[model samples]
Target chain A: MDEQETRKAVHDRIDQLDVPQDLVAAAIETGIDQASGKQVKPRRRRHLGRWILTAAAAVLLGVGGLAAVNPSVSRALSNVAWLTNFYLHHDDHFNSFHVNGIAKSMDQKVTSNGVTVHLVEAYYNGRTIGYTGEVTGLTKAIDPEQDWVPLDLDDTPAKNLTSSTSNFEPTKSGFRFHATFLVDKGEVPESVLLPIRISNVNGVVGRWNFNINLTQSQQKHAIQQKPYDLDLPGGEIIPVSMTTFASGAEFTFRTTTDGRYGFIGISAIKTAEEDQLIDGTDGYYASLGITHLPLKEPLVQGKTYHVVYQYQMKTDGSPEADIVGADIERDIVLWPAEQ
Target chain B: MELTLKEITWAQQAVAGDREALGQLLKSRGDYLYRTAYLYVGNQADALDVIQEATTQAVKTVAQLRDPNQFFTWFTRILIRQAQVLYRRRQKETTMAVPPEQVAPMIDATAHLDLLAALQVLGADYRQALQLFYYQDMSISEISQLLDVPEGTVKTRLRRGRSALHDQLGGNYYG
Candidate 1:
């Protein structure tokens, strides 16, 4: 083939590969949001504690927080207090893995300038890294008016790491904290030394560094199947794949055609008897794009469940250009009978 | 594809802070950007990611575009950089089990498939030069400005890249 033939061949191959119209619309909307300075920021839940600190906070605070609290009960509770505290106030997902003994117990602690930060326990499932710990003996008083940076983690291992922290429930001395980090790209190593540096506690600059070892659990239970194609309006087909992990269910949508932008959200997951699998008390999302829905418990085998989801499509960049929105329900059986 | 007159007008309007025009312009050029990104990243998911991020970056920094007509060049430059970052990051990853796609015979001896496979094995710098010169129909001067490399370097890379591809494909020669 000559130069002209080569160019034609290159163009022909590239022409066969097309990016879905829905994704293009999403990208354009993201761009417009940036240009208009209307990019939505992720909300951080902090200082809005509805539940008061009970025996759990005193366990971390030691003798300083609650005077009437028993020292014997505090020492007894300190060992497993962070675990129960994390489940009660923070995430229900951790309870699923912790109950299965899929977590590593850690008692690593660091002290700096009359303050102490403990790394209690860590849980990893090859997708997310979670920690439940506490900070005690903080000299600065808790102020609702001022934003506090109780911890600063050096997330060098995964540069695109996205993290979320639970509310700092202030104790008499300090507060008990929980954090979860997610690396979106490739799978992290089986064993990793996560370097965490705590500084600017209550706006005071002090470096308290610790290298916490996190290991991916070998006992994780997960199931995934071949892609299931969902047909939409205007001859568009989206291949949706489902993966159920011990902690949650992840739904990944594979684009198949070109037409318009689309948004999908999972409203609820319910069994055949209408038993809800997600905790209603906790905040569940009507997610955008691809997302993982954390369940209260894993779905049982040979059981039928209804996944109620909402979808909307947009043909243009304008907000008013949305073409259709509807709720659809899909029935799926885990480990279905052999065909 | 070369920038059209209407696209140029949109770029000028986008620089002047008209977000709607910017959105329209991005929508129009989305396919081109997506294809270019796929060439660099070698996957659909990462290509989409690169396009989305590059779009956001472009929209946020459109005001810095002194020459509105150079919007494609500027935007393509941003996209290539982002694609490279993701590509490099993915390269560092190690999987325990061999992926099925890697083991399978991915390409036949067809001209397009052979060229694609040859391009995939080429060095990053060579691939970029060839991609711009052939796929995007860009001149050496344009590529030099976009890559911030001297014209001589761009020409040499195109020569070396074409030679490498020719040797791999056995007969095909890039212009």
Candidate 2:
């Protein structure tokens, strides 16, 4: 084949592969939503969140809390070990869930090619859906640092799925896996069908699929909600209804301005006693629509925390990273102390 | 490969934080992006993942593109980087039990199977240069700018890649 023939062949070969237009459109919509800060990118590496929380964890020390880890489920199979370990070693982000009793036991299992993948338990708090499971039957232990567990949701409702972060640990039989899938859609359905597929296990290749049902947790209700009017520079007084939860806070506001405006990030959430500096997760940055902020520490009851945010011109992609309570014109929404 | 006036307008609007315009721009280039990603990853699922990730990055950094006419090149660069990231990450996990057919999927290229195989055997750098130069209809300078390499380096890769393909196919494939 000559150069022309080769070019035609290359084009023809690439064209042979079908492009799913629906999926592509969905991805574009998702990307726009995330870039505009309607939602966060699904999977975040979280090294920064963890490192910043090291100090918050120290401040939260001796702040005793309690709630029973669901007693009805089999303690042996439903390995909440991932959550327990995360709370113990990594950070106290999951401590609120543990205290709020927000986990559901999903003791489902699928086995293939001498391997068993157990979908043990799941925690769904409106915004995030996390799963912890066990994998038995491996030739050798997996190094979680180097090896990735190929557990992924299949393509039926995958368009709604944004990002997922997973962790694996070596077990005697195989390994245990913990993964969290972020749902960016504002109104999450009562139940979502997660068709999980594991394409590869160690060097053993085969599809180990599981159709796990995820029901949204009822405990996600706002413990405290209040209406506060935010005065924008353009003389636009946007009424923001802030809802605080054990997980984080949700800002529900509508803007009718012609100028492009979106909720970027909250710089600080302050109380009479403590001023907690937030990583960008505290709020989604953008020009319009609802913004969900996952807070590092749960709001303390009977404490009036002042959630202060400043509107600044977007420098790079995430200006929230550099937000350091600089003396700029700011907006404050008062969350009157929870009684 | 030339940018149309409408596309240029959409790119400008997209960069100016117009979601509708951005969505339109992405839909226009969606197929091309998918094919490019598929070329690197060699599968449907991974290719889709690459596109989605690239789309997210594009939306995040579209403002960084100073030239609206260069949207295709800019987005392609993002897609290629994502494809490489996923390809390298998954290379370690895939096993030998998976048949070659499953990896590349079935394409009706009975006459061009040898060509495809030869292209696959070429090193990553050679394959990229060849694909950009031939399939993407890009000049050496354009390929150099996209790949962030000197124009001479791209020309060398194209020459060496053509020689390698000619040696395999037993003809002047690049003539």
Candidate 3:
């Protein structure tokens, strides 16, 4: 069909699209009450949250963010919270850490009765991540009165919201970097073990590290922290007005297992533990006072070594209680550091 | 308590816990959201689910909206997001137990799908950007405001969305 014919066909079909009755009822229920009061000065979306998290891990693992130095085990450390995703695949030459996965969703929505949120992933196989996914549900577009830092998708910020705009530029997305690129991938090391810390209402539950470049026998040696501290990867904190028997605490913290870019949040839950963990603890960091190890050319890959830290925790001694330990493991591959 | 009260009564009653006003608002725009959703999702149930979520999100965040005139665009973005979310969820459920081979294959080779199939080819961002630019007949600036993207990024997405469509529709790309 010609362009005009195709346009007509598309237009014809669009007009015929029937809107569901119940859906109309639901949206109409929204009644025209607009949000116009308080203004929130929108800073660039939070990126340092990832950095602080890795710093927390460095405090835990003793090596302090050196896992990226080893290229071999980089994939193993990239495992995430529950869905267990984002395996980094690298060709012989380390240019980009190609990540692929069938993006998943937590189909948690009810009719006009309940609401489910979809978080948008920034990048998928190197495509611009759209505003879909549960993350979008977590963010509210700033009210117009509020000043917003033009979105910088990369891990940096320079402002894009100007008086007028142009067409065709990477910065044009009004986002500086693709969301995925916001967390730059580290090179692969021969073997790397990053033990990360997580805190919860139960106290600081535990620390788990991903050991990439593990030998067949070494995979089992991967560290596993029980009672998965939903707050390990610290997130935005919203004060709660109510609590329940099953849910009594704000449990959240940080994670370094997923490399520099692995920042996760628990938006809402049957229990507030996950939500507290993600939204809380943005200002937390164990003051790095002790002398960190300084010996070899950094924790490079293929060189096995154990990391040990002397740290303290909150009073809870329960399995989910807060405590600290030394990071001990061996034999890692060293990923070349980019000069 | 009056006849006119039933129709325009929502203006105030909705704020005072009047379920009728809530009911009226839903009755009016719910279908609109679902239609926009269906365009993106192509599934009835998924589209309906998207509408509900979009409504709820609107309730929570609409307070931040400046004027009511932008509700369509604001809620459309939400509906589009809802459709994308539903599609992702359905894709996950449909593949829950399917082994590696039975799973929905990634769009590696684009030569096999038809025009409609090609519409399904572009990822959510690319497809939405194209639809907004052409089907919606929205100017680049309008697309930017709607998509919350910079205009240049809007053009890039439009270009890529068009190219992907071309590949999927046997080199028949429409912007």
Candidate 4:
């Protein structure tokens, strides 16, 4: 066989390998939804007014008085740890989760092939779940930056799963890893069996399945405001809603019908006094939470806040725009402080 | 699969943030991407993972792409990077946990195709260059652009890779 024949053989062999149609369809679907800012599944409608009222009443009864004296209750509600171990060592941030005495501690370990993973503690506050653990008996050092430890929810309805690992260090035996997993509101069950798999451990993939039982505590302090319809440059109107929790305020911008331009995220947030530039650290954007702004001041109900956002063409193929000058401002009214 | 003019238009629309166009673009390139991934990872499941990850990365970073006409090249580069990452990771695992003989066999080439077996024996760089050259039918310049190397480097690799294949399977193997 000559080069031509060798080439033909190679092509024929590659063509013979079966590519699963289901996988292709799923991949295409996920790509479209992510690129379009569409939700994986349509969110079930909840009675926003009723739920907010109930959450507010619970907050008032639980920590309304403590909030006045220390302001820690309100602060804690605003300082949400979006990424695992993000604020773990930051005493001010990590202490807030413990202050409410809502966080649960567990000792679960899974050992396989000379590797052992110990899950120490976890905290779930309706929206995000954070857990910390240590691994031992691994010959190779685990670098979170290079390694992908994906949290797989078995027999659960979790969606939009985002995770972050921090404070990865080598121990005498192995390494200690802290990770946070974020799920959409009302996704995880009371008890979930989460299989955290380190897809690449120096190339040896391993999984540790932990049965986590969560105790639901009403968010100690939460304020919900009416959704605001904001106009864009292209004559498109997007509905923006703000919900304040103990960890932070979650701002959601609805996707527009025209796919040409979509809400990327807030560039700057203007409170009466100052303009805060949204560095990526401040928040993340998806269709859900356009930004989860950690509040400097407890959001007073009925008080209006101004938000400045930068929009971009949805796909990379779109022509470049002056995003710096393309700031769209909208005044958002907070729901009444008291029902 | 060869990209049609309509698909190129979709690629442009996709880069412009049109989700439907992006979907069409992904669908058109799905088989090609899968085959490329399979060449690197040598398995169905891992190849699928590579494609999924590459798609996600492409979607997230599509805005950074400058030329819409270069969408396939841009996306293919992303796919190759993903495959490389997975390949490196799997290599580490196999080296550490599994014995050489115990490692799972590569997908069986048809009987009498000793060249396929010989291809596996070649270094990753050589195999990759040869795979793109013969299997994907890519030009040296295209391979160089995708690999982010000079055209001369791609040519050298192609020459050396073919020579290695010939040496392994005997000179008449190619004929």
Candidate 5:
């Protein structure tokens, strides 16, 4: 075939590919459900403590001395826990620990530029730290397009800092703002004094300096680490270490120097469920930290686990290696019966 | 496809947390997304799965989008990424037990089988470049933006992809 005929042939083939209308409709329906938050399953029962915290705060504020004397209210207030439920529900890394009850309270507040910013709650697991709070005092809605960096606690921005903001339900004083920030796995400090400066908030800037005590959560658990050698399809052996935590397992390996051989991902199974694939985290290239392979349920001390590591080989000029396929390199059994 | 003003408005509303607007925007681009996904996975069922996943991801992360007018480019990027991921996962699952020749016979009959087979021999980057060029008729600049690569890289891929395709199909050069 000539140039014109080749173009026609390729175009004809691509055009002939068909998409079913029913599939399109179903996909749109599913997208709408997910977008509207209908598909998000209700979080674990641990979140009930958060609801109790909210209720306790309201009663303490409303009834004053009378509510303080109530046994249940007093007990809840003493717990004064920071709920990691929001992060636990959304992030795989944060979900590894079975955290219940709040940490120590750092309910600090400041007023400047006619706006009040409150640091409502803070939680520090062994790995991740997060804080949630609110900002009030605005005549009109702030620009939705602008992403205001509210605070910079550390000398540098945390490697995986994530922040989210939502408008509070409208009240007579106007709509307040609720915001939260989660700093991913980083070096933990005893205490951090976060200096907050929010600019362009209804034409006025808000500033606050609050000290947060990174009190370790009672729910933190120690991870058991074991080292092993994983053999790839091409007979190349790579050293890898595995760590098992309450929430999931982490595999750490070194990346290849030639950029040809690399760890792709892993699949794992407990006795109760079928094999489930876990995608490698965005942090995979950071010395090959295979973070967050969540178990079907939280890890039990004696339950056996089976896992297989997958790796890819991409040697130049090797057609066999050029095939885009990840092969299972090694199978591992965790918590052997003798152990 | 160039987005109309109404589609752009829908995208803006979708980014502003309007579920109905998201549905409308996704429905408008569903066919194109599915077709593009099909080019990557080479099967109708897997392509549909990729489209659904891409739609869900786009809706969840819509707030991060900066420009409403660039919705197609942003969504296409998400769709292609999802397709690549699913394709990789599928390859891993069947690579040992089943080879490409056995799977080719099961592909949907609507597509030209010979061309599809030839396309499979090209590297993923080359196949994607050729598909976007000839199938979607996207400009090299547009493809570069969609792929998040430099324009020069896109041009090189197109040149190399055409040459590879010509070689695979016995010097059937096009343009």
Candidate 6:
């Protein structure tokens, strides 16, 4: 059924469950009586009660993570895994939820179906971000004709910079590094990928770091492009240079006649499924959290661009990565400066 | 003007510790407040407790109110807050086991199992949002204000929750 019909039915059912009359009277009386009993006789000389009350209220507000520390409520909502997983934004121009995690590397293998896909088979590390792979695509329901579908936040992929809790601020934690590219036409921009490892090398032991290897796609969506610089809302932005690492993957620039050197590299590869992906299952859709998106306008001819984020092993200022003793190099490269 | 004078006289008498005037005021509003509380907690017993607690708290607090005309919204807000507090507290401790006592009642006797299954399937946000908006007859702005979220956010929740509930019910929501 269509969306409007669905809403009407639920609204109707809720309407049918009316609260009995006697209950309302009891509730009002309780409120009035409760208010009357709280009047404190004004102390003629001492006046320090208000400050104490404010301090106590502040303490109550500072309790541990409202969801995790509260067990009973979690159990009540336990059946709702997808809703719980999404970043709950109580305020935003367009309602949005974000999938956040830091992975050293994700495996990449593209088949010859002409449909390039990122096969995420593992839920390990943190590559397991989106609610469902089928629900993916910045705007389209993975399968548009399905009798079942997902609620898309917007028809475009937004560079998310918000978190679930208002006071639970976002920190420079858990991200290795990210790369971004905006696709356009004329010159096809190569797929941006990076493989990251998490093992600490500063004589540090015990915690297991990670190793990720990324590959680029041969399909080209560009005809002409230019060097694009991305500005992120949080964390630092660095430049990539011609450098050789242990795996023989070097990040360098493709200099044009104008003397501007653009960048190319791998970002992630996937070999396993994430915690929740759209696999045809009976109750799975209800339980599965899928990120739905649709591109309203088709990719600009000869002007398609994408931002591939590059991450480091250390998160939240944790000095776990020992690469050249620098905070694992986090960088971004836009394939074409012009489209 | 006459009714205003009457209300003022009653308020003065109530403030002066006239138990009868207080009783009249309590009886006048008791049922309405209880219904609001019931809509929030979704349980008669819990609703009763919320009203009792809010009543006690309001009694001690209302004497300090400047404008008693705001009695309905102010009192409703308190009851809503009390239910939310209990819901939050309950979430923490019942992580592993949620007894049937806490679930919403079945809508139909014959379709009890199916309805229970449907409600169980509906996400907490959707069910609660639907309950508050449709069952409680609260205004969209009221729900958003009470929940400390933007009005648009509440609309999105209602949309999503209703869609999911429709899926669970195996037909268009209009059914």
Best by DockQ: 2
- Candidate 6 lDDT over B74-153, as tens digits, reads 65677778877765554553333433222312212122434334554455566667766754556789889867889998
Q: Model 1, A242: alpha-carbon shift in Å?
A: 5.3
Leading candidate by lDDT: 1
All models, DockQ values? 0.16, 0.18, 0.10, 0.15, 0.14, 0.12
Chain A TM-scores, candidates in order:
0.57, 0.57, 0.21, 0.50, 0.49, 0.18
Q: For model 5, what is the error of residue A18's alpha carbon versus the real structure, in angstroms, after optimal superposition?
A: 1.6
Please give the TM-score of chain B in predicted model 4. 0.80
Which of the two, 1 or 6, has more TM-score? 1
i-RMS for every candidate (Å) is 14.6, 7.6, 15.0, 9.3, 21.0, 18.5
Give the whole-model CA lDDT for all candidates, comma-separated: 0.59, 0.58, 0.35, 0.55, 0.51, 0.34
Which 10-residue window of candidate 1 chain A scores lowest in summed lDDT?
A58-67
- The better candidate by DockQ, 3 or 4, is 4
Residue A39 of model 2 has an lDDT of 67
lDDT per residue (tens digit) for residues A1-339 in model 5: 654575677777766655565557666676556656786331111100111011111111111111111122232222223333333343332222223343334556665545555655554433334555555665555444433323322211223433321223232332233333333343334333232333233444322333343544223234344443455433232324334432234433333424555334444333446434232221212323333332323444455445554555555635365535454533454432333
iRMSD, model 2, in Å = 7.6
Proportion of the native interface contacts kept in model 6: 0.32
Candidate 4 residues A190-285, lDDT tens each? 433233433333334543444454544333333443334556544243434444443344444444435556344444455687644222221233
Give the runs in model 1 whose Cα sits over 4 Å from its true position: A1-103, A125-128, A140-160, A183-193, A218-231, A234-257, A277-304, A315-320, A330-339, B1-175
**Which ten contiguous residues of candidate 2 chain A have the minimum total lDDT?**
A48-57
In model 1, the Cα lDDT at residue A258 comes to 37
TM for candidate 2 is 0.45
The candidate with the higher DockQ, 3 or 6, is: 6
Could you tell which candidate, 5 or 6, scores higher by TM-score? Answer: 5
Residue B20, candidate 1: alpha-carbon lDDT: 85
Docking level for model 6: incorrect
Candidate number with greatest TM-score: 2
Better of 5 and 6 by lDDT: 5
**Model 6, runs deviating above 4 Å:** A1-339, B1-32, B63-69, B99-125, B136-138, B171-175
Docking class of 3: incorrect
